[model samples]
Target: MDFGCDPGEWTDAWSATGISHHWALGTGHCIAELKALADLMDVEFVEVDPA
Candidate 1:
Protein backbone atom coordinates (compact mmCIF):
# COMPACT_ATOMS: atom_id res chain seq x y z
CA MET A 1 0.00 0.00 0.00
CA ASP A 2 0.92 3.70 -0.01
CA PHE A 3 2.87 3.91 3.21
CA GLY A 4 4.52 7.01 1.80
CA CYS A 5 4.69 8.70 5.16
CA ASP A 6 6.24 5.76 6.93
CA PRO A 7 8.77 4.69 4.38
CA GLY A 8 10.63 2.52 6.87
CA GLU A 9 7.53 0.64 8.00
CA TRP A 10 6.20 -0.38 4.62
CA THR A 11 6.37 -3.83 3.18
CA ASP A 12 6.77 -4.65 -0.51
CA ALA A 13 3.68 -4.29 -2.70
CA TRP A 14 3.64 -7.97 -3.78
CA SER A 15 2.53 -9.46 -0.46
CA ALA A 16 -0.24 -7.16 0.81
CA THR A 17 -2.42 -8.15 -2.12
CA GLY A 18 -4.31 -11.48 -2.34
CA ILE A 19 -2.89 -12.22 1.08
CA SER A 20 -5.05 -10.02 3.29
CA HIS A 21 -5.88 -6.40 4.13
CA HIS A 22 -6.41 -4.23 7.16
CA TRP A 23 -8.49 -1.12 7.68
CA ALA A 24 -8.79 1.11 10.76
CA LEU A 25 -6.03 -1.04 12.19
CA GLY A 26 -5.12 1.05 15.21
CA THR A 27 -4.16 4.49 16.42
CA GLY A 28 -0.75 3.90 14.93
CA HIS A 29 -2.27 3.18 11.53
CA CYS A 30 -5.00 5.73 11.12
CA ILE A 31 -6.65 7.76 8.40
CA ALA A 32 -3.68 7.92 6.07
CA GLU A 33 -3.46 4.17 6.10
CA LEU A 34 -7.10 3.92 5.12
CA LYS A 35 -6.52 6.45 2.39
CA ALA A 36 -3.65 4.40 1.10
CA LEU A 37 -6.01 1.48 0.54
CA ALA A 38 -7.77 3.50 -2.13
CA ASP A 39 -4.72 3.27 -4.40
CA LEU A 40 -4.18 -0.38 -3.70
CA MET A 41 -6.71 -1.49 -6.26
CA ASP A 42 -6.61 -0.35 -9.89
CA VAL A 43 -9.29 -1.14 -12.44
CA GLU A 44 -8.80 -0.77 -16.14
CA PHE A 45 -11.16 1.62 -17.96
CA VAL A 46 -12.74 2.56 -14.66
CA GLU A 47 -12.69 6.14 -13.48
CA VAL A 48 -13.64 7.05 -9.92
CA ASP A 49 -14.60 10.48 -8.76
CA PRO A 50 -12.44 11.77 -5.96
CA ALA A 51 -15.55 13.04 -4.25
Candidate 2:
Protein backbone atom coordinates (compact mmCIF):
# COMPACT_ATOMS: atom_id res chain seq x y z
CA MET A 1 0.00 0.00 0.00
CA ASP A 2 3.00 2.26 0.26
CA PHE A 3 3.19 3.03 -3.43
CA GLY A 4 5.50 5.94 -4.10
CA CYS A 5 4.40 7.44 -7.40
CA ASP A 6 6.54 9.92 -9.25
CA PRO A 7 4.68 12.55 -11.23
CA GLY A 8 3.60 11.38 -14.72
CA GLU A 9 5.35 8.05 -14.30
CA TRP A 10 2.25 5.88 -14.01
CA THR A 11 0.39 7.79 -16.71
CA ASP A 12 1.66 6.01 -19.80
CA ALA A 13 2.40 2.78 -17.93
CA TRP A 14 -1.30 2.12 -17.48
CA SER A 15 -2.40 3.63 -20.78
CA ALA A 16 -2.10 0.34 -22.66
CA THR A 17 -4.67 -2.45 -22.36
CA GLY A 18 -2.14 -5.07 -21.26
CA ILE A 19 -0.71 -2.86 -18.55
CA SER A 20 -4.19 -2.05 -17.26
CA HIS A 21 -5.01 -5.74 -17.14
CA HIS A 22 -1.90 -6.42 -15.08
CA TRP A 23 -2.80 -3.58 -12.73
CA ALA A 24 -6.21 -5.13 -12.18
CA LEU A 25 -4.62 -8.46 -11.41
CA GLY A 26 -2.27 -6.89 -8.88
CA THR A 27 -5.19 -5.14 -7.21
CA GLY A 28 -6.99 -8.46 -6.95
CA HIS A 29 -4.01 -9.88 -5.09
CA CYS A 30 -4.20 -7.07 -2.57
CA ILE A 31 -7.88 -7.79 -1.99
CA ALA A 32 -7.14 -11.47 -1.58
CA GLU A 33 -4.61 -10.69 1.19
CA LEU A 34 -7.16 -8.60 3.07
CA LYS A 35 -9.72 -11.39 2.78
CA ALA A 36 -7.24 -13.92 4.09
CA LEU A 37 -6.49 -11.77 7.11
CA ALA A 38 -10.18 -11.27 7.84
CA ASP A 39 -10.79 -15.00 7.63
CA LEU A 40 -7.95 -15.74 10.02
CA MET A 41 -9.53 -13.42 12.59
CA ASP A 42 -13.06 -14.69 11.97
CA VAL A 43 -14.22 -11.24 10.96
CA GLU A 44 -16.27 -10.06 8.03
CA PHE A 45 -14.54 -7.62 5.69
CA VAL A 46 -16.92 -4.71 5.19
CA GLU A 47 -16.27 -1.56 3.24
CA VAL A 48 -19.24 0.38 4.60
CA ASP A 49 -20.82 1.29 7.91
CA PRO A 50 -22.37 -1.71 9.65
CA ALA A 51 -25.45 0.25 10.62
Clash totals, every prediction = 0, 0
lDDT of 1: 0.44
Pairs in clash, predicted candidate 2: none
Stretches off by above 4 angstroms in model 1 are: 1-29, 43-51
Lowest lDDT 10-residue stretch of candidate 2: 20-29
| RMSD for each of the candidates | 12.5, 11.3
For residues 14-40, could you state the per-residue lDDT of candidate 1 as single tens digits? Answer: 345654563223343454554565567
Error of 1 at 8 (Å): 40
Could you give candidate 2's per-residue lDDT for residues 1-51 as a string of tens digits?
Answer: 333475356555546445434222234446778778778988766542213
Error of 1 at 44 (Å): 14
Best by lDDT: 2
> Candidate 2 regions off by >4 Å?
1-29, 47-51
lDDT of 2 at 27: 48
- Estimate TM-scores for all models: 0.22, 0.33
> Of the candidates shown, which would achieve the greatest TM-score relative to the real structure?
2
Whole-model lDDT per candidate: 0.44, 0.53
